[model samples]
Target: MKKIIFSLLVLAASFSANAQVDRSTMPKAGPAPEINLSKPQSFELKNGLKVIVVENHKLPRVAYTLTLDNPPIQEGDKTGAATLSGALLGKGSTSISKDAYNEEVDFMGARINFGSQYAAASGLTQYSDRILELLADAAINPNFTEEEFNKEKALLIDNLKTNEKSVSAAASTASRALLYGKDHPKGEFETPAGLENVTLADAKAFYNKAFIPNNAYLVVVGDVDFKNIKKIVTSNFKDWKKGSALPAAFTTPKNVVSTEIDFIDMPNAVQSEVIVENLVSLKMSDPDYFPVLMANQILGGGGEGRLFLNLREDKGYTYGAYSSIGNDKYGMTSFSASASVRNMVTDSSVVAFLEEIDRIRETPVSEKDLKNAKAKYVGSFVRSLEQPATVARFALNIETENLPEDFYQNYLSKINAVTIADVQRVAKKYFLSDNSRIVIAGKGSEVLSNLENVSFKGKTIPVKFYDKEGNAVEKPKYEVALPEGVTKQTVLNNYLEAIGGKDKVAALESLLMVGEGSVQGTPLKLTMKKTNKEQFVQMIEVMGNVMSKQVLNGDTAVITAQGQTVTPTPEQLKDLKAESAIVAELNMLDDETIKLEKIEKVDGKNAYVLALNEKKKAFYDTESGLKIKEETTQEMQGQTFVQTVLFGDYKEVKGVQFPTKLSQSMGPQNIEFTFSEVKVNEGVTEADFK
Candidate 1:
């Protein structure tokens, strides 16, 4: 009873003390907190491999990163040799079988991977010794067999092919290739031709010459003693011989004299990829580093940045906008602000980007912007210090970038010291908007005319054309005249004739299609069923779990997703009922609103574009008379999205031709579904619509 009375008295006194303090006055910002960061221990081996170790006992695990800090490799025709060679490593060593090596690593729940010039391994502290030994064996004595080389080469080429039609990929390559000439190491990109030229001999030669111990650093972090790690590293790498000195210098790339637009025409692009880039020479040790970092943060760092607010939030041109500046110790790097925007606003987005860049350069950032940016950096730095690997990385960076001993130690203080003046100064020095290369990769038919006359502040920017491979080319002839005497009804009749006869199509009672594809690496299956009775069912599954289901029966339409069922409005149900036919074109043929808009290219083939009302369009091949593509405009959350579907690989089933391949694009995602089964008048019943 006495203790309870004492506790109540203390609580009452705390409340009385709080009531006496002033609550109206705002508090001043405090100084940067002093970070109790632990420094990593370092040692050098006789073979010139430097090791840095950071001990953290909080987690009974360890990680080692072997980075070859060498100059960028300029591979002419064999541009992908280093990447392929890196992938070839860690498959198996001369000492262990491939299956055995992978099985053991998996059993230990560890990850071991290698790249062109780096290797990483992590496991529990108890298995650290074996992990390091396996890593060393794989790195030093890689099994470079012909079969493995073929597999890796094919995989690399496959990746290149996959990105062949990607607008963003084309923009990225064109930007770097223009910033730094294609001959420079920083500008070189992998091509299928390059990968095909890369023989096993080239990979072996690159590995022998580039993977040297002289310029490599092995960073070890997590639970381990410095001395024990040093001993084990020494014993494992002592026998590895050091090669000749690596290349240390290269020519720095220069920026353009004035801002200009470089446009690449891709007829299939649904949106435009805009990139404004300029070459700048900056390094980690430079005094302007911290200020440039802050400037980028305030300019286009994240969703809060000015570019995002203007382009996405205000103008509604894109999903997001961002900017980044690269710092390189070897050669000059680039500063780029970029976005993927609707094709109609490609030119407008470019101008908005330039305005933001110029605004940051001309005006001094407000004190609030400065404080917020600093707070973000300070918070991020303090949180990163909690990770033991951060300590090891800091040590390695200091050694590699020639930074001072206490560079990361005073990181937060330096960030906090940056004033608005510093941000404006760096902004003017680095953000070279006047001498920028505006790269726009998109459909020439849609955006070319607008981009040709794009003006910022009454000064029109000249537009230059280039092919997707970065080669200068003449302005493409986008207009292909429609053939003589072709009307909407003729096109519709041709499509009906292309896919089975009208009589056969009308006689069909039911149809079912089963297709398989993946979205972001998740297995997706689509099952669609339709009956002549105007009942339709569509189901989408991810990994065999139904993600969404939609059913249209008679005049009612319902959609089920995430345990919620929603009924479509009368207008939406009318549109859904129009698609209840087995072949939609059969109904479209009777609609008077459908008209032939024009003839445009769809995947390099001339196709007839039919405007199916204001919200949808369909493209039909002029020669084959088959419906090749469909486009629809949808509104969700006050934002508009254009979804596209490309149909190809037609095969005959039940005496009617059906599309076997379907590629769909919704916003930023593209899924290619390959049909495995097509049943006509079978595999579907009235109960399926339930």
Candidate 2:
């Protein structure tokens, strides 16, 4: 007890001595901390499969990664050959059935995945040998059965269809097509026709041709010993015969002569996607690498980036704006800044994006910005050290990309050394604002007119039209002059007549509908009811519970969600008044404020557009006169966004035409509701609205 008391007194005295020295002055950061990066021991098998082993005994776990480090191969007519080869590689080995292999891997609680260019497996350290053997068998002795091939092909086609209507997918396809050209393998996407052209034989041929060990790398990290892993790797992968050298013939993609606009029109688009991109040849080994990354970080790499601050925080144009700069060793890489913004501000958003890009190039970044960028990179690098996989990746990168042995160890110092001038220099060399493709995939009919006259630095940037497939086309005329005989009343009357008739629609005193739908893949049930008294109620249920409910009783509107009830805003009240009607178009016919705006194409079909009181726009197909789509501005959870509701699969419900499918896309997710049954003038009462 006396000794403990003396030790406590000494400790307190030591703290008092240090605390009395200085409390106000900023302490200097000590010298740079030494980095003890694990150096991987490596070897090679007879067939040239390079093996890199990194040992970390902290946990009883192991990870194995086998990468075929080869350049892009041209598949020509077989665009998805390599993709199929990778998909079918992990089905089974010659010695084991597919089910048995999967069962054993699962029984061992390990994960094994085979890709066209790589294979990976990770689990407990005790199962490392077996996992490695499984990987080898899957890679070297893969059995390409016809049934599995057909299944994979079918899945690919199904995914293609799912992505067909996705705006983000369209943007990706267009960007790749523009940057790499559709003919290049880097840009080429597998289509239904192209996938159909691929066969089991073709997939096998691609596997035999590209899955060679001459340019392969195997990385094993975690609780592993170099000697033991070396033995396991040698026995399994020794038979992976090499000699499949990559074809050297390739073409590098080049940027445009000058800054220009490339537009792809999606008539249903509510938000415009802007991508400011250019070709850049950047590698990790280059001296400019760190500077380029820092420059991007300052410009648009994160929430604090200039792009996000200007567009989202300052202008309220988008939810987020981000930039990415890729360093591809085998193919042309790109530097891009992108955002999806409101339709009304599409031109301003584009201008803001370009100005930000140009401003970063012209002016040097502030000291604060530079400091923040450095701090972020430093923090990220430190956090990455906590992961064994990161260590393995770094080691593999050192060998494959030909970096200095101490590159990762010196990463922080290099990032800290980048100056404002270095940032500006690399920005000028890589960003290429003056020679970039301002790719805008949007509803061009609404934005093009506003954008074509938009001037940057007092010079107007002209717009060029392109189809969704990246094929250049002429500009589409938005406003089609109607003949003198076709007046607003004529169009409205045509629509009313097309739907069952004026009297029949007028007889729709009430409606009650129950339907099933999906929201980002979660199943939801919806209930909607309306009465002739301009009152409506909507409820959304998930898993047999009401998730949200919107109600309009005469002039008052309220919405209840997540156990909270709130009155609708004035703008929401206005919008609800229109929706309260059994049919919005029916109410529009009586209102003089609404007018026939113009004739535009909806999915390539001529449609009559009606300006619905400046809050919404309605498109009715010209020949059929059926209301096909309606776009409206909505505010939810304090965010203002555009909601586009597509009406299709029309069927006569009693005396009126009713749409069976309703699709709504808000922000990024698309939700669809297909009604199995809808009844008009049935099961709707005033009590429901109350």
Candidate 3:
């Protein structure tokens, strides 16, 4: 009996193995089962509320969405008022406190969400039939209370602070600002200041003006009877009042005539963020919309896009980069790229980004590239419908954009019909290198000078500072006031002597200086090398590793661990030159005026704080008694670090004595460092740089 069972099992396994065959060689299978799509029914209530219902009995759940099209037509600074009002609505309602509403929703397994766009505001709720009445109550009778409004406002402000620290968020905001002028309704970006100005009065006024039933559309989808849904909506919204029709809020802006470069300086940045944008087709109905979308895909839309292939795979300047167009009532298109290259190669990287854009416009995409792009797009699109939310969103887009009912059904056909000529034409038309607005956010002094030397167009480019709202704000100009009894010449010459004697410092073969410090309680170490070239290695043992290198004779700047290297942008190059100048000035300081103050135990190690004072302060007499303090400390990584250096300590290294000892307390551990040998005037040679 056992032998017979074993033989039967082996036979079963063999049969199963043979059943799997090569799908490509097999006969074509029949089409999949047809989807039972819900047909949407529409009606208008007595109070002018437009209702749309799509009945789906596949599951015991329902989803409701309400939208209001009352964007601010007469704009002052009321940009995000509608959005804020929608957000505050869910905090509480007339009959229920916020806590009560939250608890009820949680117990019933339901969700409610609300938001606003430039021309519309929307709310969404999902729950079973048993809790449908509660959802209706929250929607129809929102409290819009003063306390709730203030609390929501504070939350919005806090969220803005968190977003400002993200590079991607900042880039997106900056790109939109350039696409639409700061004042334009379509382009208005949120800022901490704008959010702060929003009050209970603003929320109330906005709600009253925009949230009327007449100006809104309610969409419901789920396992509910059409008649019952209609009856429920009518009874709940009967008391709602009609409102005046709102005028369209967004207007298309004229395309910029020339390319402009904007810079946002993030001091002590290890990488430079770059974005290039310009106007493109705004209307989904525009003849160029499809072509432009397909063109961007071929250029820099994803992993296989032109930018990723050249910058990441070929030259290795960035970990990744991409570009796309924002298709809305107003069109704004842009190509953005980023790299954390050495401070020296910032210019080279910018050149490469520009070159890729130019190539896409000048050269028509190859047949293979076009085919691959279409295949990827179509495959991705088909896969997206696998999720119900995506399918619903696709259907909603057709309704919102006023697109043809057959749009999704014909999507693949449209993508397949795009020709090589279409790609080339759109690229040439939209990729305007001269008119592109270039924005660079990085350490300004380390990247700007070199950028200026490179001629883009016929003239030198000017760098402009932008506020969080994307407004061009003038930077505050101020002169540094020196302490009393300091002369300009004494400060300049004596500071140089402190680093090392002028000749000895100039003849030094190479210098390696390690710096450690704390930023917001996070310990950080910066390894700096000065030879024929310059480089900085930033290590935060707790956080990880980051490195940047710039070679004097080469145009390339490299960020090793990230696998990125490229020429610096024109702006980046300019900053690098300025940084070199400051370093050069410090190398010329005198010794006697600059001396180590004393050695003291800091964080369990012998550490020294060097002090430097200028011998003559006449030429540099913007201030007197100019002093620099340098603190040194040691770490367990077998590294001696200069922790906190005060440039204001005027006597140690003449005018700049960097702290040689320091420790930063983080959590339960303290990151400490101590510098071992302090040598000035060692002949730092060119070979050391490489």
Candidate number achieving the greatest TM-score relative to the actual structure = 1
Q: Write the per-residue lDDT of candidate 3 for residues 305-337, one digit (tens) a residue.
A: 888887667766566668877666524434444
Q: In model 1, which range of ten residues has the least summed lDDT?
A: 29-38
Can you write out model 1's per-residue Cα lDDT over 1-690, one digit (the tens) per residue?
A: 999999999999999999988989967768767766567888988889999888888899999999999988788788988898998999899988888999999999999999979999999999999999999999999988899999989988998997887888899888888878888888889999867788999999999988888878999999999989988999899988899977755567888888999998887788899999999999999999999999999999988799999999999999999999999888788899999998888889999999999999999999888888877777778888877767778878999999998888778888988889999999999998899999999989999999988987689999998877688999988788878999999999999899998988888899999999998898999998999888888889988888998899998789888778999888778777767778988888779999998999887888999999898999999899998999888876666777889899999888889999999986678999999999999999878876
Relative to the true structure, how large is the alpha-carbon lDDT of every model?
0.89, 0.87, 0.59
Q: After superposition, how far is residue 273 of candidate 2 from its true place, in Å?
A: 1.2
Task: Please state the error at residue 99 of candidate 2 in Å.
Answer: 4.1
- Candidate 2 achieves a global lDDT of 0.87
Candidate 1's TM-score reads 0.95
RMSD of 3: 13.4
Q: If candidate 1 were superposed on the true structure by all CA atoms, what would the RMSD be?
A: 2.7
lDDT of 3 at 434: 69
List the candidate 2 regions with Cα displacement exceeding 4 Å. 1-29, 93-100, 487-489, 502-514, 530-535, 543-545, 551-558, 567-588, 635-640, 652-656, 677-690
Q: Arrange candidates by TM-score, descending.
A: 1, 2, 3
Number of clashes recorded per candidate = 0, 1, 106
Query: Candidate 2's residue-wise lDDT over 1-690, tens digit each?
Result: 999999999999999999888869877646555678888899988888889999899999999998988877888889998899899988988899999999999999999998999999999998889988998998899989999999999999988986776777788788888888887877787887789989999999998888899989999999998889888888888888876598856678899987888888887788888898999988888889999889999999899899999999888888999999999777679999999988889889888988998899999989889989988888888988999889989999999888999998888878888999999999899988788888888887878888897778777887888877788888877777776787667788888888889889888889888889987678999899988887989999998888999999988889999889999999779767777888766766668887888888887788888887666888889899998898878876555788889889988899788888888888887888998879998888778987
Off by over 4 Å in 3: 1-38, 69-75, 117-127, 130-132, 161-174, 194-196, 249-251, 330-343, 456-690
